[model samples]
Target chain A: MSSIAKKKGFGASLWDYLTTVDHKKIAILYLAAGGLFFVIGGIEAMLIRIQLAKPDNDFVSAGLFNEIITMHGTTMIFLAAMPLLFAFMNAVMPLQIGARDVAFPFLNALGFWLFLFGGLFLNLSWFMGGAPDAGWTSYASLSLASEGHGVDFYALGLQVSGAGTYIAGINFLVTIINMRAPGMTYMRMPLFTWTTFVASALILFAFPPLTVGLFFLIFDRMFGGNFFDHTMGGNTIIWEHLFWIFGHPEVYILILPAFGIFSEIFSLFSRKRLFGYSSMVFATVLIGFLGFMVWAHHMFTVGLGPTANAIFSVATMAIAVPTGMKIFNWLLTIWGGSIKVTVPMLYALGFIPSFVAGGVTGIMQAAAPLDYQLHDSYFIVAHFHYVIVGGVVLAILAAVHLYWPLMFNQMLSEKLGKWTFWFFFIGFHCTFFIQHFLGLMGMPRRVFTFGADQGWDTFNLISSLGAILMAIGVIILVVNVIITIVKNEKVGNDPWGDGRTLEWAIPQPIPFYNFKQTPLVRGLDTFWIEKQEGNKEGMTYAEPLSDIHMPNGSIIPLVMSFGLFVASFGALYNGEKDWAIPVLVLGLAITFASMAIRSIKDDHGFHVHKEDILKNEGGNK
Target chain B: MSHDAHVYSKSQTEYEYTRRVRREAMRGQVTTFAIMIFLTLIAFSAVAAGFSEYFIVPILLLLAAIQVVLQLYYFMHMSEKNHGMAAFFLYSGAILGFTLFLTFLTIVWWN
Candidate 1:
């Protein structure tokens, strides 16, 4: 019995993960996949820096350079950062709310597989012909003019992946809304779960526009439609409208979770309850609400005229108020409390100043006239990297360190973590901060190279050097991860000793079924409150010991996603191949067959009896 | 099981009564669906006939807005639970999205 319960061999573990429908395991899959993409995107960044290291460099061809930059942006934002945040949310949120699993476990597995296969299909373009060369936005006129299958790949890949994201978002919404533990009121939920709820709602609303836009693009390119062909009585500006409507909220979708992470860190390390919790929640929802209103701020340079510009500009500025409320709340969260300078706290502290700089620049761009000069310039690039890297990426790194023990029962070495933070932080500043000045000096973005006499050479070199430093920092982080996993040093619940959320209330390795009995959430920071009241168990259960129902793991989701993967290839080759139609039909049949089977089958899940629970009580501990 | 059978039947009867009440609550949704179908037909007809294209577009858009409300309230089950707050959030997003589209169209096309 102990041997069966102990660690299995490699193949056994592999099989377990391959068929696992557990949300936590799915989170690990997202992390692993997202981490791979992050590294690939980072390498692309290095290539970009190398090409621009000196003025008039010709290391990479212009077309190829465009492909690299396009993939870098698209991959980082969609594939790396968002999924990594999803990883954290999946790993923690259910535990926070004291749910055994997400609302739809099968759908969760399908979501991960769809994302994986879609990303694979997109990157396969590199070997098949070429990756997407149009900028990540793939603005209509330019994309329509571009040759080869690059834009086609972008549309199809994003459509598949975007559908997956939409599914995951809806799942989070239903899970958070309906599956909360007894006494876990909306107001009493942890900030991260709250942000996940709001961000998921944003995703639910934001992604449909992108889906519609991608459909239009696909039809125009592949199916002989003229939605974007201006000469054929089609309007190109419609594409811009559709993309930004999705694009603007996409930014908030990425950053709001970063805000949630910092909120948790501030309260935890400072040993203080989050100040003005309700107001912080209010601000988050408000920012998400206002996010959809300001899409046209990106169109100031596209000449939407004064009335459109002024309305969007004002609406864009209004977002700053809610965001400002959050900043003050964080500062107050740390005020007059015992502060600890952990590696995560360092990133949180660094994020405040860095993200403020990014936020202010965003406001500056909100001024319509000012943005006319800044649009498509290095300044816009600098502003977003500060927000994305300085804000979101930093949060990912911090959460990796902070939540490592919670997720994997191992702690990343603090010594190495601090080293990673400094190098990456300094490198980030060096790389992006100078680009702001470069933009001010009349440098346009998305250019392969610049002329030497333009006085941009030195800054470009410095930026390239900075990129190398950031790479080193990432290498150190990888080393830390390897070391921690190999050592496998165990940590107990509340590993930080000041964790304020329910996620930290569970012991390490976090049993396949989290929370033998659901915890009764009392108030904001319920776990923290329980700790203050001297509860060593770290929770107060709402229910007595009883049999717990658990859904059986299934491989059907993988088969379902694989069917779509096959159909995507068929769709891609529809006109080119003789067998394409048959393949498409077969693939779709597989998917529908699986769906039919799932719908008709009754899966009354088995229960872990009370005696089994007693037997396993101290196993994880 | 033997002793409780009578009580179980009584509870089942009560559940059937509640189910009937729930079905009655869905009468509003039947009307909503009918109205949606009617509006969609009108939109297709106006666009197809090409009559007063300018005025027809606005009328069509207004009807489309009504259909959106019907879908939200009826199909999405938003009417049953926390209806006020859910409606507030959904409508706010819709209004903002519509405003963005209109503002862009006015500035870029009308101007």
Candidate 2:
């Protein structure tokens, strides 16, 4: 929370990050961890492509391939995409609404550490035994059949991380609901804030089902409770129902924020107010609501009967209406005003056509009978990749380019950015576009290899080549990030001059307490409104400057998360190890002790007095 | 804007406004308690009476739900202003949970 500039040693910086409760700093933590996992998942993806590149290739055994694929999906969805999106939400949403900080900054730090520990625990499966081979969904029948501790890692790790995700969701919900500065009404909130709100709600409702499902997985595997054991009168399909019930909304939980990022980009870069802004809000919430009703669509091939299938199919397709509303609104937003094709905007432009293709395929799969053909095929694979990659990944990348200055006070190389986008975009279409055809040509997904005589070799090679191209693009992005960080050339507020929101209002090197005085958010694009009126300050204060009360940083969150990480190992070896029970008890004691200390401690936190503030301000501004 | 001066003696009108609001709140709580007790008694009698299991089940569920709503609105004070966000989330969670339950009942229970 230090506003004063200082240079510190590496160890001091490390210690600061480890204990910091600041939202902006926490965003950096998420970005660093999620980026590492993203690279891990990417390597896993490349391995998968390589194994399938040529017919009967022995790059990886079938068993190892299953492990790789399972980890890739689980890591990308849980560890990478969601956290990256969270990074943006943490970094920008509070600023956008003109809040000094999030509602519960300590809880925010707790969420990050919990996620990090959980992800570490899960990935440790590679050395502990083998990784989960039952796929990311961890369907009960397959996961129960899995012999090693892989599925245990998947279930327990997700449980821990999912709890963190749920906590973060609640934190954001409370922040957005209560912490808006004077006059920042729900209707007046930026689309990103609105989308974060809806997405948090989605997380609130969606994650419980996953928790229940994972608990079932854990009980069946570790405790021998037979929640999904068919012999014990438990039905495996019940797991599918529960998983998809959570799983479907989880998709929206990822995409809606991505949509928010794109919406911000379209409006800001195009120099226009977001078109049909209310409808866009409506669509976001509508998408979240509709997201729940369509879980059964994923289960269409699971034999839920014709009536169930028909209902779910139609409900799933009905979602296209609100989604179509969003797409058209974006098209109309950039229709007339001004269009600047910056890196983020270029990605936004690329997104429309790519996501539409994905949506079209999604509708195709929504048709139950058609899904009968496409389900578990490479086509389904292509369809989801389009949506997740083209929609969410594009948005994350675009936002990184867009908000880098805001987060780090440095700009990424835009010249290299276009090169990254084209390579990734072209490579994305090349890899997945052919997979759709492969699915249509009777090629199944999750296959380690195919017979060369089947005539799938050419398409497989082409897709592999495309994957390599995509890898090159990601590597370039890494290089670009390195160059930018090394250069660290400082940039000012509203780095893009056509800044539209309150996030753009603050000056370079954002103050520890974001707004020195809580800004009066008059309307949508509040800072833009002030800037239009020639207010160089880009804001009008709701109140006079006063002493600011701020929370002190604590290391309890890391310790608490580490407690769970230790306990997970104990749980993993339940009856097999004699020390397991004692270990579990020890871990629980540590966690509870930390909690007790947090509760009993009387740290009221210090405030910056007006004299010190005025002194700091006297010579600065 | 100092806290010490802002906490200085309040005017008579401000005290009267606080008194009126408290009285209204008290009355609302009393009425809600009476209604909740009545709903619970009805739930018990539905089980006490000899009726079809289906009839008793729906009746008990309905009555229980009504009581829960009362508890949230009155006892928990979610009905009060500034709890709009709370109400939205409560209803949203309820709708999603109920939807999941119904889907499970329709698809899973049948098999």
Candidate 3:
């Protein structure tokens, strides 16, 4: 109720965060949770590398190795990368578009809690009995044969989290479509906002297939359903089709935001307008559309018939045209501009050739016959890491440095950031580059260990050493974060001094209601345009300052997510535990009761009066 | 002042025009509802009349598709102005769903 800025006690702050529907606080929650999972996934990766560091090594048992790899892939993709990107999207997208908040703030909170609880439930598998060992894909035949409840955890946990992702996707789509400030036409929207729009569209269309596939898996395992039971006239290939249908678009959903982030960085540091802006937008939408048509490329080795393979092969290769257009666009963006070799710009410069390398390998695999040669080998492994790590991971590191000032009113050490970049970049290439040769040398992927006679000893050792260097880089990053937070050196808005968007126009330590008055975005890079026109405020007010309506924080989202979390355990234990049915019913009842209460209660959100806004502005000065 | 809601009194002519438009919309909705009921009845009768299984099934599907279009346009007011984005998303979802089924039929079930 207090409109003026005031510090709260620790418990009060904690309670505020727990009930917050504010996009900024929810973003911080996502960052912290996603960072935790990133580290966990990193540790799992290290375990993989250490186990493979030497020939015939037995650091982890074979079974545990499977579990580690599965968790690493599932956790990194579902929990770490996607949420980290969402963290950025939540933090910056609304600001870029000059919106006060996302369309559904309550659903936004629910999405975060659902993801957190789902991730928690999935990780709990390690302690409960075992983790899923059927690989991240969890192919039906393989998963159906796997013992214990590991695969069940995989299915149900993803079901809960995927729903969250789906909701978040719809939320973003709606927000971008409906929430742009006055004079901010669709064509005038920043590249980051445009890419977010397309990425959210991909998520909206893509996630339903995953939900359906996961449901099929859940029912088959838990309720004696025979959807995947080939012995009962079920076809196993259907799972492959469903999983890839979702999985292919899932990659785009991760990468498009990455593309958006890099596009922002490239333009910001270059001190120039994005090169071929419309084409960049065109390429993004093109990639999103093409993303759906080529899922079968992943299954070229599955003998989906020569005709099917040929059609998909051609479609897969066609994606490179748009992707290549993007690469050239970024390069041209940096060409002849007053480029600042800042940490983010450094990553953007590094990303071009690295992503191209990944894309070229992708084209190679698009040739169905060539894929047969590379399938299930270290080559396939190398190709994905190149795209994902080289592209998305690099963009993530860059955005961390770029948006650190925006998120927290402080700056990370520039020196430490550059050092982290070099170490990580070099380490990444060193780790995956030789894997191509190793794959060509006939070494396979997912094998726990190889014998000395396989001629892969030295390369595996090098790959492991590279992984160690990457870990050291990450450790340095963690140290950098700690140092930054502890120092808490406050920064002003436009900390980068070359900010090009509306986000940088806001005051430092941004208020909960982001913009006091909605900004009139005259064109792309609106802040830059304002700066060029000698505007001191870096903004043009769309209207006079007025009362702003803001949603109240609520705990219903957490309770609802908890209901699903509790229900997952019940479903996991069904047919085996005596109380499973009761637990299931109880959990659903809790969820439904919370829903009823939410619908019945009328919460007309409070408004900050113009008088309070004036006082707050004075206090800020 | 910006937050204050302003109540505007419409001119008599404007009020009459709005009333006529609403009445026309209601008529359209009622007519569409009747047509949807007729389509459903035809589908049900086709099933009950012991036609060839293939003939009945396709006809029922066709009728169902028509009913869906009517439902979306008339009942859901998708034909109204300002529903462009909603319509776009709905059709996109339909197209994507259709593609998935077609792919499934060709690749999974047929092969």
Candidate 4:
């Protein structure tokens, strides 16, 4: 176990990663997996764009187009964006808060495995029969009416991963609440930690409704349940209600971390204390609270009554106040400071206008009547891509560059990073900006192709061209990553030299147990404060050197998730396969047995002795 | 350390304060327990006595709600110091849940 840090063979490293519970290792695992999925989703995006490149194009069958778009949306949101954000959160949040690891390292592993297995199960649809084609939302009536097991895959796959998300969310909430280092008050916590806290709370409250909704969906399709079978006294609209309830908060959950990342970038590059810090925190919490109240805004076009629509419309618009406050705060943070236009700062600067554009459209949609015009149009598509791609995706890319040095102790090519940013940022606007006019010009969303006579040919082609540019940008990024990893130049700690938060205080090749002794956080941006006060070792130790207890890695999380994975197969094949019942039983038994073993086994974890700690020279400069 | 100090020579006043606090906690728990039992009986009797359906149903629900609060505050020690975060989260969750529940009752159940 002590030899875990030494460079080893691929097999050994693989085995270590498979069983390890260390947050740092788990973070790498998340990055690798999430990066793979992100590329896959990117490929799907390219395919969708190619199909829509020209009017009357026969690039893909209509049915296959449906599948492609669905997979693209589902994969990007559930698999790519969320996990990429999780990668950052897992990597940085604990470090930011001056904690060794998250509260439940084992559950952290479980969450990752569950997400992976569920994603695998979802993608397996491509090989099996078909992929879910009822849009990402999978609105009940359309989904139920659609033939085959596509919808089933959607329901069960999301169900599995949703559980993982829920677990991870709860873990973050507990970790943030309970695991802060001495003198690290809630008020003193970094904006990243605060965002993580609020997002986790959103995840906690939001994912349950998704779970229940998914179960209702699963039962409806698979087990002959009538939850959404309107013929049997079931209401399809209930699914809409349930889905949006989770769906709306899900947006905030994605964006808040993004907001956090950009906040860090803005402050770091600006080399200033965040402007309106408390108000930013207040806005985040207020946004989260308001997130729940306005789920009905999604259903406004569903005729949820004029009164309901009017109320929700007003409530939805109110969110803009806090969001607007955030935008201004970021702008003010950048005002008159020692600003460095690094690649990350470039994206952060680009993000303000992009996200603001997205926000204005959102408020427009909130008007309910305007939504009637925009619903199901490319405008909504443009709007969301503006938000998700503009905000979250940009943040992910920025964080990738911003924290690349922090994560790997190596610097990415600044030149290539800038290229990726310009190409992507410009390409993003080119792709979606015209789509707004296309929608206003009356082109609908999720339609694979339009006729040549529809007068949408040139614009569609432009959008596709923009997508191609974005793809080139992504390719450049991939190339950049390869070059960086291959070069592997060690740039020690605080490569940016303006790192404000606790994470940058830790020296390069951060040890498994992040901090040797949990550092005393004197104030916000604790590391910056210490740096200012001329603390050479980069921090003040809260406690003296002592034996640190660390959890041993176990394969139980993998086995438990595999149990669910296997059970999903059984559930999918329930009526058709002769062996489905036995398989289901076996899977459930495996899960229960694993859980029992976990509970019964007296694994108190191992301790890193004080002598060993002294021998390992870590962050101490 | 506190246990060792108690085992050694605790001041009379300190011991008395500790005992008094425990006694009060015990009394609160017992009182809440009795109230819960009485509420349960009332719920049962109201159903058993065949009152109006609406009356019995609402009454039972109200009693159940009260009992839950009693359980959380008394038996679960949520009223104690340092439980503010717990209380905040629990109530937040409850409020969110109730909002969803009300939405279902009003809109989805009919539609």
Candidate 5:
């Protein structure tokens, strides 16, 4: 067994990834799958823009256009953005806290598989019959009215994926709370880890509502349930309340980590400590708390009356103050320091102005009366794209550039990166900024097509042009990635030259098992402090050398998730087929059987001898 | 070694730690089960007592809220360390859930 562990070939490596429970390798899996989904979603976005390039254009049929828009929104949010963030969190958080792995590595792998299968099932609807034609929200009335298996795929797939998300959330919570290295106090933790902690907490509370909502949807469609049947004393609006209650926080869950990423980048590139660090932490917590309060703001035009609207409007506006505080803190951190305008720094700079524009418009919409005019319009679409694309997507791109060396031990070309950045930045604004006017000019959103002479022709054409530019920008990014991988140029630890966090202190191609000795965190920005004092070791040991206990990777998590994936199909086909019940029971029995084995089997982990550590200096030294 | 002595006595058994956690889990399960039963009884009684449907609905809602609290604290372990932060998150969700409910009722049911 030990001999086999020392080396393997391509087939063995592929099998290892399929079944392994290592958080770092699972992160790579997430990146590959999530990147694939991102491109698919991007192609869908281009199609929507093309169809809208001219009024009443038949670039796609009306039904097909709805499906494209729906898939675009759903894919971008659930499959692409969230998993990419999870990739970074999985890859970086344990290393930051000096832990060898997350608290439950098996569950981590299970989460990835569940998400991957769920996404695949949803996309398969395109080939089987049709895709979900309702909007991304899949509001109750529209979804119920839609025919075929589109909405069913939407409900079932989200149910499976949402469960995966819940498991991942719980795992992060336990890992952060229980696994901090000695001397790594809560207050001394990096901003990125703290945000991950808070975001996981949000996921814990938020996803259950979505689970409940999707369950109601599945029951309504497949079974004989009447939870959302308006004629049976059931209220369809309840679904809206449930969806947005989960949905609004889902927005913050994506953006807050993006904010955390930029916070780390700004401090590193500027060669200065974060200004007002404590206040920044306070504002982060405050934003998470207030994030739950503003879901009703999304419901303003649904007729909640004056007082309810007024109260929610005020509550929604309060979120802006803390957000404003964060913006100022980032600028102040770079105000009097040696700021290097690298590709990442350029994106961070771009984010400030772009996100601010999105923020102010959000404040404008917080006025209940003003929202009545903008609801279900292109203006709302523009607003979110600005916040999400302008803010979160930019941060993801910046992190790709910044953390490339940390994750892969290679640096992307700076020249190609900057070109990608400008094209994307300019094209993004060109696409979305004008949509606000189209909405005010009386164009409704989510309509598959519109007639000519609505005053939206030129703006829609311009938006389509911008979408092409954005695609070009994305292509350049792909080129940059391919070139870098081909060159495989190795970089040293602290490749950016001004690293401040614990993650940067670790050696490149970070060992599969991250830290040999737990690091003693002296203060905030521990690495920077040690650098100033001329400590070459880059860290003080928090503990002496000892045998490190490590869990063995297994294939059970994959099988368990796959069992549930198979059962979903059985449940969907229940009434039409004779084998449905048996198939469902058989699938569940497989899952439970694996779980029983897991509980009964006593598999204490193996240990790495101290000598093995000495021999492996080349790995992560 | 001295620090270890202060945190854990040499005579203490691993069994003691395991026993304590087991007791906590057991107590939590019992409390959560009791609350669920009590809430269900209240909901049923409200319907049987011929109360106005409006009154019955509100009473049922209140009982459901109590059950939610029990589940969160006992089953979800929200009452563990960092209780203040945990409570803050729960209360935040409750407040938003209430606002959404009220807004929907007002808009669709009222004028």
Candidate 6:
């Protein structure tokens, strides 16, 4: 009954988070869960390096190594990188557009819980059975042959998580399209919001094919279906086409938002308006469109014939045009402006050359004839890591440093952050750069070990050393996070002096309902415009204060996600166990009954009265 | 956040104009409905008439396409002004789906 700050017991706080429908709280949930998976994936990476450190050392068995590598790729891409980016998106996008919450708050919570449970179910594979040893791509040819319950876990877990991702994607699309505040036109939105919009659209178009492919995989593996079995009048290549159709855009889905993050960092630290803003937006969209055109490039070596390969080859190389434009736009953004080498700005500067290096190698491989030579080689490995780590991971780190204050009202230690960056940046190149040459020297990727006499020994040793350095960097980051949380030093709004978006304009400890009065977005960099015009309040309100209607918290989303989690286990054990059918039925029944209850009950939310708002304004200020 | 609705009374001319517009819209809807029914009957008769297989198939497909457009424009109100976003996304998805199918046909199946 009270709106003032009241510290509750740990149990109450735990329950609050469990049922919370607030976007900010959901964002925190995503951050914590995604961060946990990042560490898990990092450990997997370290294990791989340790195994590969010295030739034929046998730190891990070959089968376990396969599982480690597969889990590393799967966990990093699906669980760690995408969800971390989603954390920033969920935390910042609505605020950037000046919306109180996403268009669907309950669905937002459901999305996070679904993602968490899905990740948990996938990780549980390590204990229940051997992890999925087929590569992260899990091509039908390999996955269908793999014994044990590992691939089953991969298919069912991804199905659960992918649904969550699809839902989140749709939620973001609707929120961006329909929920902008008055005067916040599409053109006036921040780069992060623009990128989130494009990425969500990519998700909308991309996830369906993944869903289809995973279903075929599940059916082929668990049921007696032969969708990929050649003896049964089914072709395996269909899986490749379906997977890459989803997979290729999935990379764009990750990196475009990374581009958006760096765009913000570059402009913010340089204290300049983004140069060629329209062109940057254009390039982001162009890249997203072209993303769909180049899925065939990943299949060039699959023997689709010279004509198909040539057509796809050109399409793949053409993506560089927009990407090159983006690189130059960042350069121009930093040109002649007051560039501060903050941790984030440092990452942005590091990103340009690193991503370009990755892009060049990518173009080299896009030539079908050349890709035939590089296929399944560590050179291919180097090319992707250079982009993924050098691009997406770097952006994730920079955004963490950049947005930490906005999210938590406390700043991460700048010195420690810079330390983490250097180790990570150096270790990233050191780890993967040599692998390109190792690949050329005939070291195939995903191998458990190589002979000491094969001339790859020294390079593999160096790469493993570099992986250690990267792990140290991550460890330092974890330490930094723990320290920041423990200190909990409060900071005021616009902690970054040069904030440009609406997110930075709100008072510290942003209200559960963001923006008590809807903000009037005049133009790009709306906050900067307000500050320059000597507005002490740091925003121009479009409307007078009024009672704010907020959705009530509910446990339905958690229960809904948990039901799927339970059902996944049942589905995973379908033919193998007697209890599986009942469990599956019970789980579906739980989900459906809860859904029916939700539809039947009318839970109109309460309003925060105008008097309550005014009372809080004094304390917040 | 007051939820009170304000009621407005139309002038006599305004009321007449609104009524005329609604009547015209209704007339247009009814005509479209009749045309759709006539097209369906033609399709059924053509099938019932036992035309050559090739001729019948193409005609049926063409008629079905026409029906889809008519249903979308008239019944679904896709012709309305505010449906631009919906239309854009729908068309984009359709094009993407077509492209995927074309790719599969050429590379995966045709070979």
Best by DockQ: 3
Displacement of residue A216 (Cα, Å) in model 6 is 1.2
Model 3: residues with Cα > 4 Å off, grouped in runs: A1-4, A618-621, B44-49
Better of 3 and 5 by DockQ: 3
Ranking by DockQ: 3, 6, 2, 4, 1, 5
Clashing pairs in 3: none
TM-score of each: 0.92, 0.97, 0.98, 0.97, 0.89, 0.98
Q: What shift in Å separates residue B107 of candidate 6 from its native position after superposition?
A: 1.2
Model 3 lDDT per residue over A488-535, tens place: 887878999999999999887787788889999899899999999999
DockQ metric, candidate 3: 0.51
- Clashes within 3 Å, all models in order: 0, 0, 0, 0, 1, 0
Cα lDDT of model 3 overall? Answer: 0.91
What are the per-model DockQ values? 0.22, 0.43, 0.51, 0.33, 0.19, 0.47
Choose 1 or 3, whichever is better by TM-score.
3
lDDT for position A181 in model 5: 79
Candidate 6 lDDT, B5-107, residue by residue in tens = 4699999999999999889878878998999999999999999999999999999999998999888888898977778878878888888999999988998
Residue-wise C-alpha lDDT for candidate 2, range B1-111, written one tens digit per residue: 122226467789999999999999999999999998888888888888878998999888888888888898889999788887777777887888888778788888876
lDDT of 4 at A159: 93
Lowest lDDT 10-residue stretch of candidate 3 chain A: A612-621
Query: Which model is ahead, 2 or 6, in terms of DockQ?
Result: 6
Tens digit per residue, CA lDDT, model 6, A1-621: 123568999999899999998888788888899899999999999998888888887899999999999999999999999999999999999999999899999899989988998999999999997899999999998999999999998999999899999999999999999999889998998999999999999999999999999999988987788999989999999999999999999999999999999999999999999989999999999999999999988888788999999989999999999999998999999999998999999999999999999999999999999898999999999999999999999999999999999888899999999999999999999999999999999999999999988988889989999998898888899999999999998887888799988999988778888887999989999999999999989899988788888899999999998998998888889898999989998888888888898899999988888888887773243
Show the lowest summed lDDT stretch of 10 residues, model 6 chain A.
A612-621
Cα lDDT tens digits for candidate 1, A408-509: 877899999999999999999999999999889888999999999999999989989999889999999999999998997777667788888889888665
